[model samples]
Target chain A: MITHRVSLFVAVVIACAFLLFDRAEATIFERARQAAADALSPVFEVVSGPVSAVRDFLADIQGYLAVHEENARLRMENAELLAAQAQARDLRRRNERFAALLNVQVDPTIEYATGRVVADDGGPFRRTLVVNVGNNDGIGRGQAVVDEHGLVGRIVGTGGHSARILLVTDLNSRVPVYVEPGRRRAILSGDNSDMLRLEYLESDDGLLPGYEVVTTGEGGLIPPGIPVGIVAGELNGIWRVRSQTSFDSIDFVRVLRFDFPQQIEIPPPSLPGQFIGVEVTPSDSEIITTPPATTDDEPARNESDDTNVAQPPSEEG
Target chain B: MEAGYRRGLGSRIARGPAIMVPVLVTLLCVVATVMPYGSLQGIPLAPMFPLAAIYFFVLTRPTLMTPLGIFAIGLTQDLITGGPIGLWILVYEAAFVVTSMQRVFFVGRPAGEAWLGFIFVVSLSAAIIWSLASMFYQTAIPLVPIIGQMMVTALVYPLLAWVFTFVLPEREGGA
Candidate 1:
């Protein structure tokens, strides 16, 4: 009896000591945490591989069972998507022309690499997942991760061959977003739940249920206009985001290398009789004799020339 | 003769299933945690199988399952799950100490009594873990999920306890 009590007391002391030490040298402790994760990832992979295979097999069986219903749903979705695609193409062409007219370059084009989700932070306290790609694949801190649907999260920590993603539903995640159609800006924060809380809305102006929410790129951390989710329910003045990405079965994800737009540059205006799109350089006589046609829609030659030289205002407002 | 008996007994234990069985079963419980079981609204419903195993072994065979072994199990769980470190270690060790102190009432009792005791222990364990998590994260986590996990862990205790007893039958001499 005495021995048992002594051992129990000793164990309690040791546990408390670990907690104290953890709080004292948090950096060293975090390094140890990373090391431990790196060591255990291989074991997790070996165990989860067969389990994932079984799950895939079971999902396949369930898919076959719902084949007819799924086919009908897909057919309906495909039609709508095709129509949307055609409209999107036309809008994109117009957007490009507008961009060229203003001489404002588009946001830096993002590149991506794929990775497999090998392990997850299975505890309810944290919402993080470990993927099999890391610095080797050019995945670094703050890179956005997404699936076919929408944003999952961003990279928080990286190991050599693995990286940790803070899911959008984690307590620490705060994404600046714009509520579309109205374009009201808000912060999408996670509280370790399925739904994310939308905060900091200027007045909830034009905000409603089912309003589209996308990243605003306010801090230049995430690229603007990536679809996040729609505005969801409200309780006690807290609004939620119904994320488009399915967290239950995130098997593969793309890590986007999104470099936020830094600065805007505008070129000097072309000389009269030197059309912007025309390839040929006109001779001196052609320049002297040709008339300057500055219509009302197009400002006079002097002002329009200065307008082309001036940089457009920043997109923050 | 005493020395010879001691040596023979030690060698017998080394060759026996005492160490490997409990450790392997506990390790299996750890692996069961990360298995790809379906979840409830994104929260996994897999019962805390390791907690069940720990309660059973700590109650049944305290001598074989040492405090260090318990610490290792909890630390491994914390590490793999990416939770705040020392969280499970503290919980598991506390459970170990509580069960060990109350072993007299629990040991060799009817299965129903064991299950009942497990309900109490796991509920207490869940409370400790939840409170620790809330403190660590400095926010009040919803209690619904914690309660859900506790109920599931308690419900699965009987099946896992039966497995433990079936695999390793009671010996003539006990801890």
Candidate 2:
């Protein structure tokens, strides 16, 4: 009994030491965490199989039940989308012409590696998920993860066969977002709740409930123009955003492989009357070049020049 | 000679289950706790199934689930959940020690009394974890999900206890 009591006391002390000393930013601890995750990835994958099968079965039944109403809704949505598609095409052509005339660079198309979520750390304190795609699948830390809906989270740690996603609703999550229609910039912060808080909005003018919010891509860690969520409501005088990506039903996700652009020096025009029409650098060309489509079996190659692949930006608060 | 050989083989087989069953069931509970139940909406947090197992084993077969074993289970949960490393360790260890101390009160009592004791354990665990996590993050963690998790864990404890008793009927009286 004494031995048992002493062991339990020692365990408590060890746990306290770990809690106090293990910093999240420590390299050793991070690697150890990722290694542990890799070791358990296969088990998580196997365990999630039956759960996925049951979910699919229930979904099929629900779909069958709601087939008629869903079909009608889809038909109406399709008709509206057809009209919107034509308008969008015309707008895209005009926008491209304007961009070329202005010499404004277009954002690169983001290629993503898809994976299934095998584990969900759903609790009050931290919100995260373990995805099956990892370093082997070209998934890296700081990559943005999205479901069929919109911005879900970003990769925080990666192992050989698994990666951890820090969800948007986590307390530590801070996303720089642009609130439309005014394009008002604000930091979307999470408080470990369903709704995300909008921090540092300069003016609330025209920032009503139901306004759209999206990534500004100011830091370049995340790609620009990914839909995040809509402004939900104001609480305690703080505006909140309802994430488009539903946390409850996140099954599969795509980890985007986006490389931020590096600064390039442009040379002066040598001869007189030489119209130096905005010297497009190599990086600019790389950004404009369309990458080949890749399937699940084929990982997309990083298209940026070796020297120009910028380091991931520091996380914003 | 044939009868003696059969007796030896039977003892060997029995020993295997005696050692492996509790650990396997506990591991299964850990896996079930973290499994992605995306379709199961309305409940935001998964119940602490492993905790239920710990409570049950600590009360019924204390020798099988040593302090070291419980610590390992807690570490596995922390690693899998991607939470703080020692968060669940402390929680589970505290639960183990407290449950072990109160084993006398629960040993021969009715199943309802054991369940009430489990409710106390779950509440204590929830308090410890919520406090530790809040302190670790340097912010006040929300209480709603913790309360929900506590309620779910307490509600499911009797079911797991029943299952354990049904599986290990002989050992049920060993506490």
| Among all candidates shown, the one with the greatest TM-score | 2
Q: TM per model? A: 0.78, 0.81
Provide chain B TM-scores across all predictions: 0.87, 0.83
Candidate 2: docking tier = medium
Each candidate's DockQ: 0.38, 0.51
lDDT of 1 at A76: 75
Candidate 2 colliding pairs: none
Cα lDDT of model 1 overall?
0.71
Clashing pairs in model 1?
none
Once model 1 is optimally superposed onto the true structure by TM-score, how far is the C-alpha of residue B95 displaced, in angstroms?
Answer: 1.5
Q: Write the residue-wise lDDT of candidate 1 on A1-317 in tens digits.
A: 46556766776777677666655654445556556656666776777787677667766887799899989978976896798789889989999898787665344468998988777765656778887787778987778899988889988767777777888888777877778767777778888778988887756855678777888655555666889997876778888889877676678899998764432232224333232333333332222122322111111122222322324323331
Compute the lDDT of residue A33 as modeled in candidate 2: 77
Q: List the candidate 2 regions with Cα displacement exceeding 4 Å.
A: A24-27, A56-93, A269-317, B1-17, B39-45, B166-175
**Backbone clashes, candidate 1:** 0
Tens digit of lDDT per residue, candidate 1, span B132-162?
Answer: 8887667887666677777888988888888
